[model samples]
Target: MIKVLIADDQELIRQSLQIVLNSRQDMTVTDVAADGQEVIRCVRKNVPDVILMDVRMPKMDGVQCTKIIKESYPQIKIIILTTFDDDEYVYNALKYGASGYMLKGVSMDELVGAITTVYNGWAMINPDIAAKVLRFFSQMAQADDTISVREKDMEELTRTEWKIIAQVEKGASNKEIAKNLNLSEGTVRNYLSTILNKLDLRDRTQLAIWAVQTNVRKRVET
Candidate 1:
């Protein structure tokens, strides 16, 4: 089961999210925190597999919390949740190692899928926010050049592993990856763990960013 932590200052939001997430047999909300400082304390105690972080919180904001959490506990996945769509906030959150980002209005099913998707080592961004991110990158590319690691690291992937990586780049869940690859879910998980090790990456955030940076999808197109 995937252990999750809910960190939103709003009591109703936290309780509602907890209720919805608890209904999933494969996931459980292991703890809840009201602020970033509480987030740090709760994480130290439980070490959850995923953290649903709210952007605007007392004491410390989500981006700063994400930086600290990722720096100290690289294994734990973080997904930023907020009502705001500020580009700077989203960019900083991703730069600091958040694996996923979504608006608070996201449906319960999408939220659950995102949690599981990130837990299994993949990155996710809401389609609306993804468009913004793409636009930001487009403008930034015209201003300055950036060098990124090539996805050729993925060429080292086995034929089966390659299939898994392709689906992950598409933001598919492990179950979805299993369906597409005709492999068991456990096999998909194993492939992801191997992929991370082979790439010498920290987690799915690095993998996804590297995929886009290296144009892994385009390489496959060719």
Candidate 2:
């Protein structure tokens, strides 16, 4: 069973998601929270496998909550449930390690499928907002060319690491990356960490943005 947590400031959304998600055979709502702080509390106690988080909860907001949850529970996957207008929040949420985001208008089946997908360690982007999300990532790529990062860092990555980075650019998680590169998830994680350290990037989101800007796969081909 995929243990799930629902966090939305609106009571109706929290209840609606809980009722619908619990009816699914493969999922159970372990906790429901009405704010970001409560979301943290529930997660600390229950340690759910997947979290459906609202983007604008009071007290902490989904972006900060996602960051804290990921920092404390790297194994837990979060799906930001939003109304699909907060571009900055969406970018930061994904940057902080959310597996993906879904508009609240998504059909229950889609939401359920997303839970299963993230539980399987894959990112789940809603097609409705994919273009907007990609634009946000592209902005991240172009918005700060003057940032302190050194371009020479790419030269330090091994070909295997380049392959892993290519997967990240496609929003593939460690499990998907491992399958793509014929390596274990542990090996992918290790390589990813090394790559991040070498590039001085913050997380997979940044690495993915860099990959898009640089097309690191070409390095592997060369």
Candidate 3:
């Protein structure tokens, strides 16, 4: 069962989400928080597998909370579920290791699916904002002159590593990567750990962003 934590300042939002999430057999609401501070408190008590975070909150916003939580507990997956569609929020939340970003307007089914997807170690961006994110990343990549340098620096990566990276850029989970590459899941996990260490990336979200920024698959194809 997927353990979930709902963090929203509004009482109705938190209570309503708890109700719906707890009703699902595969999921349970571990706890609910009124704000970012409370979210941190609850997490310290018993860390949940997934967190549905709201962007604007008293004391600390979701973006800052995401950064702190990921820095301290990188294993915990967070999904930014907010009413805001601001680009800075999107960029910062993702940069700070959020695995999923969905607007509050999303259906409960989509939210549940995102939680499962992120728990399994894959990204889930709302389709409404995915194009915007890609465009933003494209611009960010253009301004980043060091991407080529990073590419050259990664020359020691094995062929298997490159294939795994290509699969990651496609948002494949470890299971999918294992099946696609004809490797065991354990082997895939080991490869991922090695790749993260080699590139100094904290998590899969960063790896995927780096892949896009560097057009990694094109290099693999060539």
Using lDDT as the measure, which candidate wins?
Answer: 3
Off by over 4 Å in 3: 142-204, 216-222
Query: What is the C-alpha RMSD, rounded to one decimal, of candidate 1?
Result: 4.3
Ranking, TM-score, top scorer first: 3, 1, 2
lDDT of 3 by residue, 1-222 (tens): 999999999999999999999999999999999888999999999899999999888999999999999989999999998655567786778877899888887889989999998998767777666656766666667775323326555886898998998887666667778999999999998898888878777666677767778787898899
- Candidate 2 global CA lDDT score: 0.82
Q: Candidate 1, residues 171-197: lDDT per residue as tens digits?
A: 666677788778899988788889888
Pairs with backbone N, CA or C atoms under 3 Å apart (clashes), candidate 1: none
Worst 10 residues of 1 by lDDT: 138-147
Error of 2 at 168 (Å): 8.8
Model 3 whole-model lDDT (C-alpha atoms): 0.83
lDDT of 1: 0.79
| lDDT digits (tens) for residues 24-82 of candidate 2 | 88889999998889999999899999999889988899999999999999999999988
Per-prediction RMSD in angstroms?
Answer: 4.3, 5.4, 4.6
In candidate 2, residue 104 scores what lDDT? 86
Kindly report which residue stretches of model 2 are placed more than 4 angstroms away from their true locations once superposed: 143-208, 215-222
